[model samples]
Target: MDNASSQINISFNFISDISNIDYKKKKDFSNVYNIQGMLNIRIENELFFSEEIALLEFYIQVKKWLSNKFDGSFYYNTIEVEGDDNPLIKFVASDNNYFISSPWGQDKVIAKAKAESLIESIKIFTEDFEEELYRTYKLNPKWYI
Candidate 1:
């Protein structure tokens, strides 16, 4: 909560894929498939998502945004932030874009701060990943994106 402000505003909207496979897979879960595709980012204290991938090229670019390891899971091994208990988020290609939604907040934000800082914490927690995890992640494109 912001100390200066009496009320704290929370924004959260999890977009689900519009498909039986996507819907059933997501099943009201945070990490599933964004049928319309999403490029989530955070600046200041707010979060945002480029909900629509109008072009196929953009879809590929967004898919390339993440490292291909997680199985619909969202977690920073460097930090203990719990990605939803479900599988990790996945990128499924589709032509629908206008149906994109706002950049929604995750149900659980281990720390209410910038995305880069939160990622840094997780890197430190991993223990075996790297002694220079933060230093490395700092150079990552996501930091600037």
Candidate 2:
């Protein structure tokens, strides 16, 4: 497959039913544990995963992985929502190529792109997600220790 044709698209919306929950804390920070959202991911122009997910946990995991510097390969499992099983997503970087895969998917290699291209896509997704959280909730999430 042509690296130029590979793509990754992600978008999510925060569920708006947290009025009863105490999300705010001291120092103007908040927790995302109770927050819910529909996360949609598409790879190579095809829908890969679309379902409700634990928005905060997902963000933290992705952020942590990105902070690791994308060394050799990175793996992440989506936090199960509403009793659903976690979906394993893996990204392998080798020789300037990136291979994305999932055990639950029909194919082993769900998508492939140049290493730089794939990393850029993920960075954009993370930045956009962070902005959305701050815009909607008006509080920064307490970093996961």
Candidate 3:
């Protein structure tokens, strides 16, 4: 693979009404948990996947993946977030490369790129996302990354 040609892009289009969240009540934080959004992933300038997902939950998963040093596979189910069972989207790492695929039947790699590139992309995305959360929603939730 040509490292120079590999790239990863992540962007979210939130569909939930965050203004109604009552920050005073801890239980109301569920509003954040239930926040829905469209997660768009692009690799090598091609769309890999675009799906509706739980925004906060998905952010937490990505943070966990970063904290784990990309040591193993990271999985997230889009349908599961909707309270239904579904196939999982997997990110697997090997020899410093990350392969993303939805392994419902076969090991079909959707996109593959270097770990450093993915990490850098995620870091940039996280920083901008955190800022947006703060500026737009006054949320500076505890981040694990």
Candidate 4:
């Protein structure tokens, strides 16, 4: 590992509650579902950057990677800006009830590597989200690897 390298660890969560269901005939209060996780990545032989700037770069690469991998428009929910440094990246998939984090590293290549790791992690699931994407979008399954 290079001394100049940097690492970013991002943890995120997505939650949905059925509180909108006003049940007139039942006593049940509400139903909820939460999907959350964490990711840690390190970029070697690259320059070190602040956590905030690195996160922004990671997210930009994520959007690019997804667009290249799958066709059609994929939009993120939040790109919050704070303290006038740079815009922060946050992705929320309300339709699929997904909460995901952008990858971070010293450079674009490092950030991309982290994003690829995330895709590989998805392939390990029994109900693989990446597989579903392949089927739905008619994409090559090997791309995730």
Best by lDDT: 3
Question: Per-residue lDDT of 1-145 in model 2, one digit per residue for the tens?
Answer: 4554356777788885657346545222245566678776677777766666677767777777788887678766654522333356667776777776665544444666677777787788788877887777654654442
Residue 65 lDDT in candidate 1: 39
For model 1, residues 19-67, the per-residue Cα lDDT tens digits are 3233243333222222223334343444433232312222223333334
**TM-scores of the candidates in the order shown:** 0.20, 0.73, 0.77, 0.24
**CA lDDT, every prediction?**
0.28, 0.66, 0.67, 0.31
Model 3, C-alpha of 142: deviation from truth (Å)? 0.6
lDDT of 1: 0.28
Sort the predicted structures by lDDT, highest score first: 3, 2, 4, 1
Superposed model 3: Cα runs more than 4 Å off: 1-5, 26-29, 77-87, 103-109, 143-145
Across 58-92, the per-residue lDDT of candidate 3 in tens digits comes to 67677777777766877775545344334356767
Error of 3 at 82 (Å): 7.8
Candidate numbers, best TM-score first, in rank order: 3, 2, 4, 1
Candidate 4 lDDT at 127 equals 32
The collision pairs in model 2 are: none
